[model samples]
Target: MLVFGPVRVIHCVAMITRVDTYLHSVPLSGAVAEQVGPFTLFRSTITWPYYARPVPGSEATITADDIELVRARCAELEIPLSFEWVVETCPSLGAAAAAAGLSVVEHPLLVLERDDFRPATADARLEILPTEDDVIRQARAAVNLAFGEGGTAVGTAGPAERDANAPAVADGLVATLRDRMLQGVSVAAGAFIDDGIVASGNHQPVDSTTEIVGVGTLPSMRRRGLGAAVTSTLVEHAFDHGVDLVLLSAESPAVAAVYERIGFHQIGHAGAAE
Candidate 1:
């Protein structure tokens, strides 16, 4: 068994492989198609153009030609292509993207094992809610506001110019979240204040590992440890239900420190190009 940081590694191949596969498999409104070679292309209304690397068990070398192919596709769609990969496993991919004139940023990868996770002492009105529930609207709104109000997470492209509450964009996001929840690929947790969601998160289970994402507290409600509480709530629920591992990509050093208090340790680094 391979060991990384303080926990026995759960997804040994690469964190990017696992996360990309999960996103590709999930039901989304946009285009999800496999390209030539070991690559997957995703174009969605709610996110930047995603170019995923080869799935595990495939030995495909990504070359400049592959990058150009992806670039061409993104160009046709009029969207910026954000190619992400585990820096430890695919340095060549990062190099290729750099040579192609895309800006690449490397960030830390964090992991928490069930046995190793240190659960927080108290829960702050955390509830696991389905995406189809009435409360989901508020949760979705909270996520959009969090990302829009805060700086974009590391390894992720920034949101588009339009505000999240714009009618058409909001509708697309709501529909996408509903589909994800109804399909059982994702579960959401929220911290409520007087029946309204103030902080929210989503966890997507991929095989034995679950990826915790979208954990955010309302801007007005920050500084009370709500973000930490919400993240721990998601991880604890997954582990209690038998998830072997949970992983997340920390957007910055300060964000990484927040998770470290919840018992996640840095395992590796991931690079994103836009």
Candidate 2:
């Protein structure tokens, strides 16, 4: 069964609409968005691929046939067939995707309005990194390690593990991140100690809206509030830079609670299928 957040009622419908529109627009900068049936297929023009999303405000019922059409298009393009949507807004798509034999996961979706921003504390120094900074690779490496291990609980991977993986971090990814930063579409930040970055994340701004993503703390460094601190820095940076809304999808409810501590509230659930 696919579970979602508590924003499925009528009162939160407008927010859900706004979020759907924002998400549909975000990938346009780097992907060619094609309207296939009731879905918008974002075909990547860059190294990282994008996913299909339901057309905002479309009330068309999502049948397995619609999913199949999108899947065929993805296959023709040699890209994986995947979908992401705000479950509250596109309530029917999740079941359709699942019926089409895709594995789906529901993420706790959250957002922070400018007025709700709350700063968090961290023992290490935190700062936004410049595009040309060499530390960006290490930061990216740390994030990969964090996600690879997955979850909010503490584990063994940390600075040493990140260092071991940094050299293997693809230059193309680093280049892409730098290019996005240079274009004013993204900003990267990290929590640092003498050993190096222990947690890293970035926010991608599209006009007055931004999504804080890729936030991860080194596994061994978990439970120290570094992830929250990095997220706080990103949120503050986004607000200071004219972003009015900040959004993110956590890996689980426990992880979502971490964001809740710093003032984000659950708005919906982000569903993904592949």
lDDT of each: 0.69, 0.89
lDDT tens string, model 1, 129-222? 8656356767766666677567423322112211244333455557767777786677788887666677789888766778788887666666
Off by over 4 Å in 1: 1-31, 43-49, 55-61, 76-80, 121-123, 132-134, 151-169
Worst-scoring 10-residue span by lDDT in model 2: 2-11
Q: What global local distance difference test value does model 2 have?
A: 0.89
Q: Model 1 RMSD to the real structure? A: 5.6
Off by over 4 Å in 2: 1-11
| Per-structure clash totals for the candidates | 0, 0
